[model samples]
Target: MIKDRFSDDDDGLQPLAYNMSHDEGNAANTETLHLNVLEDVHIFTTQFELTHKLNVIQKAALLLQSDTSLDDAPGLSVHEITALANETTHKWQQPWTMYLTIVVTALGAIGQGWAQTSMNGANLYFPDAFGIGSGSARDNFTVGLINSGIYLSNGLLGAWLVAPLNNAFGRRGAVFAAALVSLLSNIGGALTQNWQQLLFFRLILGCALGVISSTLNIFAAECAPAVIRGGLAVSWQMFCAFGIFVGFIANVAVYDFGSNAWRLQLAAPFLSTIPLLILIYVCPESPAWYIKNNDHYDRAFLSLCRLRNTEIQAARELYQAYLQQSTKHDSKDKLTYFKTLTELFTIPRVRRATVAAHTVMISQQLCGINTTAFYSSTIFLDANFSKYSALLASVAFGFINFVGAFPAVWTMDTLGRRSLLLLTLPLMALTMLAIGLSFSIPADSPAHFGLLAAMIYLFCAEYSPGLGPVPAAYSAEVFPLSHREIGTSSAVAVTSLWASALSLTFPTLLNTLGSQGSFTLYAALNVVAFVLVFLLVPETRMKTLDELDEVFAVPTRSFIKYQLTVYIPWWMKRYVLRRDKVELPPVEGWRTEEYQAVCQNEE
Candidate 1:
């Protein structure tokens, strides 16, 4: 070791550690010479890696378990002392500010949910009012275009804006901007007199909703503690399901209002945006956003203190995150939006995150949940239900969708994201297949209608608990802080674009393939979703955002080979064949001790 070396132009900041070598004599002397040169080049040349930060974090968490009195611990306040004392035993206990932030995020989700399913009831009326009720080929395309306008605009324009908005204004500001736009779009859509006018408003609605979706997931994830981050992040999906349920209620309430019912349905979502605008500034800004933007370390610490229950917890996390983020780029290089966007593909770690995010987001669309979300009334009508009955069935569908997602807030952290995807994708495929086959029953039979509705409910139930929450939550958590906004925006764009394609194609597809064939096609796509998730996605539970670098660092080919050669066989022998004492290989790069400690703490 270079025992005591100092830069000639030192400004009084001491070096954290020396880079040591094991060999003695020539190697040691050479290493010392290299270190001396490095010190001369830069005062603090000993860079911090993510692993070093994780190790420090692990030690801090372990401190709560020590028997030594923390009452007099340096830099800890009374509340912070209590907070750390309760952290492991009471994981659910958190600052009210964090929960309030989650509430704001939920409202945003509700607005998007309303935007998604609000059109379900209107689809029954607007096609006729706009003079497209003739059911011709051209009319079908027009209805599809109008229905898909939001998604098309979201994919093409809004999702891409996440990076710029977030970079310039921060998460809270971006969300506030989206809420204002959402309010305007809702009013414009409600008042439109023609399909073209409605389409234009819906396109604008898509832009607002995309920004909300892209920003809030990252916002919630950043504010929440690692122990319960999954639960908080998934609130987006759970409340979105609630929004769908409430949207259906709005649809039913306004259905009897003569020809104005569709307008009322479109206008209902504006109420959710109103509160969002008022409450957004009250919530704490994301600490990660502060760290990523300008190394506003003091501000980030203050933000963390508000989000966490104690100052000590805030300080520890802030320091860990700060060190991890500092290593991403040189201190001298300036970060730009375009450079960040390109890094999503060029950097190996970022590229893997991008790939995994795209896989889940695209799979979310192809699984066909939105097909039902956007047109359940139309689907029910095709089953020979009356117009009034179709709307009622849709209300039921919306309720089931909401109820289905309630379990994920708990399971998302416990079962792990990849596990939930694997477990539910096959079930979704089976349910979609059942829905298609149910049509073979005679129209007059009660079982025909009952079975079709049951299958649809089952499909949504499976989707809500798994795919619905996983896509956005996973995408938000996987990327490094430096590229988070750009990465998540890209993933959301893929989802929106795919949703746009699905929406535009479905009406034409439904006309050509009939209900049975369309459902069957989606069933096959669910199977594809299963295979993609199984092969590409990795589990992300109970790990800090910084620590994920180590997880994704394992090569994809290695991960695949391990699954095929080790994990699959071990699983078959242990679970399927009921064998005893089967030892499975640990996933490459997972810190087993850290995971066990987390599990123990959760208990």
Candidate 2:
């Protein structure tokens, strides 16, 4: 009878046969067999079941919350409790294998960064070589289109492939496949003889990059402990910044290579892929992926052990992940790719995550970071700097971009995701405005060139720590594990689409609007991005993947209303009005009667 009940369980919970020698009762049987006991007692068993779920949920919550004692946790040894405590107190005290996984996967991001900026110096030399150097409207549009080819493929094809690739190959396998494609595409791009050939290769590169960008962040987030997941997952952005810096260096190095310098720049990013292919094998598959895709508890436990500090810690996490998976209520086999995509918008919790993900991903582009990343050298050359001077200034921009991202390794998990966005978006806007205004200075004056380069550098500094890292990390974490791939892919697709649009039109805009109007337009768009982030995005830092469900469950209107009626007022009183002892009201979750009894207070 108990076996029948377990088989019929909607939550996919296992039977009590795999029992632990703990005092709090077998976690599985407590949920499963307790109902059978109550059936003969003429009791309100449905109410009891609801109360039991709440209790189990609360226990799971404590496992992820810092400063909360785990005295109530079953089967934890003294060493295990100490390990969990250390996770909060010393967030850096992690297993070396976890760090190894972060490094290998992050190399994929570096490859992406290198691929992006490889064309910056090439941009100066290639257009003329390809007969598009006449500076006509048609030529400019063609340059933009060639530059944006990768993003076009990324949006239309690569992003959509993420779900299938991940489903078929898992996170590591998808990365492997993408890396191989990137390697082949880079080689093909370097050897291309014509504009059409170059464009075709770039489109192939974009598809691979789309898969890598969407998968690697999710892998890092899944492998990492909740306490440090933000820091680790943003490794993608940090390494990509480093890669950008190196690509600039490569461009400078190969400038004297004469006619073939552009080809070498195209070839340089492929080197990053070689190391990625070798090192990725050393990293274990994401335990969360294992738990989500199959009933391989032992495999999940083993992966967790490699990633965590202690066996007990791994066991605890493995069980918690299992419980979280059960709550998805549908089997993995039932969730087709299209159904998952549909749920991204239809399910209330998932829809909220989708909104947050799309907001950050789209805003990352609109804030105008890519304007500097893709075309800083062009923009600097336009400001009357010589070719070598423009290259040097771009190199400087790349360095500042890399250095700026270093702080996010600490601040992302500490200041929180939403706080970083709110703090940096205004600065990005102002710097962009300053860049736009710098173009008004007479081109003959050194200050014209100086101010343009300076403002672009400042904008990079502002971007690296916030929008650059937050988008991927935030998108990776916001969705439930069940919908993570499809949801993040959708968000990544939005990013790719915006990036394609920006890349395809920026050169034309520069010609038409001039540098002044283009920078100013992006600055204004940054303000729009800030408003959207403030109104719609929820804070996701320091929360486990499961815990984020509650965070995103709060509707957009509720979140926005709280920001206006509660949080904004408190901030004004406390910070602006110089008031003391003003208390802040907590943001509430969706309060349907069923959830009202079980909802834990949001911190």
Best by lDDT: 1
Per residue, candidate 2 scores C-alpha lDDT tens digits across 1-603 of 011111223332322122234334446655344433223111221322322222222233334444324775433445656887788898788888999888887799889999999988789888887888788899998999888888889999999998888878999899999999999999999898888899999999999999998888888877888777656776888889989999999999998898889899999999999999988878999887776665665577679889989765675575566555556667677877898899988887899899999999999999978767889889888887787788888999999999999889889888999999999999999999999999899999989877887788888999999998899888877887678788888998999889989988999999999999999999999999999999999898777655786687676666787788778889999999989999885565433542344333421
Model 1 quality (TM-score): 0.85
Backbone clashes, each candidate: 0, 0
What's the distance in Å from true for residue 513, model 1? 0.5
TM-score of each: 0.85, 0.85
| Over 4 Å off, model 2 | 1-85, 89-91, 544-547, 589-603
Task: State the displacement of the C-alpha of residue 8, model 1, in Å, after optimal TM-score superposition.
Answer: 37
Query: Candidate 1 clashing pairs?
Result: none
**Overall lDDT per candidate, in order of appearance:** 0.81, 0.80
